[model samples]
Target: MSKRSNWAVPYLIFLVIFVALPLILIVVYAFQGQDGGFTFKNVTNFFTDGDALNTFAVSIEVAIENTLICLLLGYPAAYILANKDLNKSAVTVILFILPMWINALMRTLATAELFNVLGFSLGKGTLLFGLVYDYLPFMIYPIYNVLLKMDTSYAEAAADLGATPVQVFGKVTLPLSMPGISSGILMVFMPTVSTFAISEFLTNNKIKLFGTIIQENINSSMWNYGAALSLIMLLIIGLTTLLLGGDKENAVEGGTV
Candidate 1:
């Protein structure tokens, strides 16, 4: 073992204690009944319960919409920012990132106040807006990083070969940026699906997403149900990550070929 390898010891310990331990507890709780006996009812309820199914569907819809909107908006912004001729691009990037420095709760509360001032009614539309606004940076940063790090030679070569700007972007830039797009989708989608606070503030507790349902369950001392719900969410996010990971890997391989 090298000395540099020892540097990971603390991180490994932290992961096991905080991350692994909590996941283990969730699994344990998810299978435990109110009488402290093993049962699969909590897990089954996720599939069989109508309310649970509705919440799950709503969460999926919101997450998908949020991800799509972010991609549509973030991709173009990232492309613009990545332009070499854009003056003060660094400053523009900084401005985009500056909002992240404030506390999330503070920012969320401020957004809620802004909506109130504008007389926007609290509903699903506002909730969607809040989700997108809060997570937009997560989408932008990944794409921007990938664009920034990309070699210009590929694009220049394509241009020299008489490829139009659209063709160059479609064939070269977009394909090469798949890894970043995948990452951004994961970052935005996962958080939006699991978000409670944004829904709460934006909709005034009228909208109950998966995260809100989990929060309610836990608060009402339905730990087993809550754990099961959380595990379901974990599975969805895990599957999404796997799918996107495959796409990213394929993109990288394609780029190399």
Candidate 2:
């Protein structure tokens, strides 16, 4: 092998041991019974369990809500940051990314404390707020990078054709930015659906998201069941990623048109 290819040996080993092995174990355990025999009970339980199904539905609902809010908020912020006339300083971009320097747990704790200090009760609202705050940066940076990298000639050409600013954005900028928006949605939506700590901290353990259910089962020594739940979540996330990937490719092709 070439010297450059040799450098990948360590990373390949790490991937097999840490990533591949863990995923294989999850799948193996997911189909195993507590007696260590092969069975389909764990997977069947998830489908038959009303509470698990309800929690999964709730998690999806929350994820969709959070993704929409982040898009609405982040797209404007990204647009402003990318627009040279609106924002010129790199410092402004850094300011938006500064919060990410701190760990998410720390930020969530601070938010919880802030809400407490203001005498606000913790519930669904706080959960949503914490989720959006943590994931908004994920959404913004993707769109910002895309918008910033985009050629301004398209918009300029549209303007020269007597297209209004709004028309230019709608016809040119928006289509070109769809790939970034897809990436941001994928980044924000998947994690929001599967995050446990943020929901726990913000809601004071009142709300039970799908991740919390998986965690609870694992903690209770229901390894097989937990693995099944994890596998389900992994499958859903994988499917979403594939769907978004297709959309991103389509957007790229459309932008070139």
Candidate 3:
């Protein structure tokens, strides 16, 4: 192999050991029974079990809610931060970045404590709040990076053509920023769907997401079942990635046109 290709050897090895091996193990365990024979029981149980199915539904609902909230809040924050006309000082950007510097668990615990001090009841509302607070940065930064790197000449030309500010934004800025929006959606949605800690800590274990179910199964020594659930989650995430990828491609094509 050439010298340039040789540089990827370590990364390939890392993927094989860390990523590929774990996935292979999950697939193996998912298909095997307690007696070590191949069986479809685990997968079937996931669909047939009412509690698991309900938990999965709840997880999807929470993820969708959190993703929407992040998009609505993050987009405006990103737009403001990206727009030099709106935000003059570079120092203001530090306010958002600073929160991310601290550990996520620490942040979650701090948020939970704050809620208690404020006399707020911990439940779905607090869970949603924690989700948004933790993942909003993920949504904002992707859009901010895209908007920062976006071509300004399109907006300038639209203005030159007597387009209103609203028209310029709708016809130009929004289309160009779709790639970032897609990226942000994927980042926020994927984690929220599989997240257990935020739900557990924020709601005091009152609310159980899909991840919590998986964790309980594993903790109770239900390896095959847990792996099946994990595999199912992986498949859903994969399908979402493919769908978003197609949408992103279409958006890029349409924007260019």
TM-score of each: 0.92, 0.94, 0.93
Whichever of 1 and 3 has more lDDT, that candidate is 3
Instruction: Kindly indicate the candidate among 1 and 3 with the higher TM-score.
Output: 3
lDDT of 2 at 149: 87
lDDT of 3 at 172: 94
lDDT of 3 by residue, 162-199 (tens): 99999999999998888888888888899899999999
Model 2 CA deviation exceeding 4 Å by range: 1-4, 247-257
lDDT by residue (1-257, candidate 1, tens digit) is 99999999999999999999999999999999999999999999888989889988998999999999999999998888887777345889877767767777788888899999999999999998888888888788888888888899999999999999999999999999888888888888988888999889999988889999999999999999999999999999999878888876543432231
Top-lDDT structure, candidate number: 2
Inter-residue clash pairs, candidate 1: none
Please state the error at residue 166 of candidate 1 in Å: 1.2
Q: Which model, 2 or 3, shows the larger TM-score?
A: 2
Q: Score residue 92 of candidate 2 by CA lDDT.
A: 98
Q: Against the hidden true structure, what lDDT does model 3 obtain? A: 0.90
Model 1: C-alpha RMSD to truth? 3.5
Query: Please, what are the lDDT tens digits per residue for candidate 2 over residues 109-149?
Result: 99999999999999999999999999998888888888988
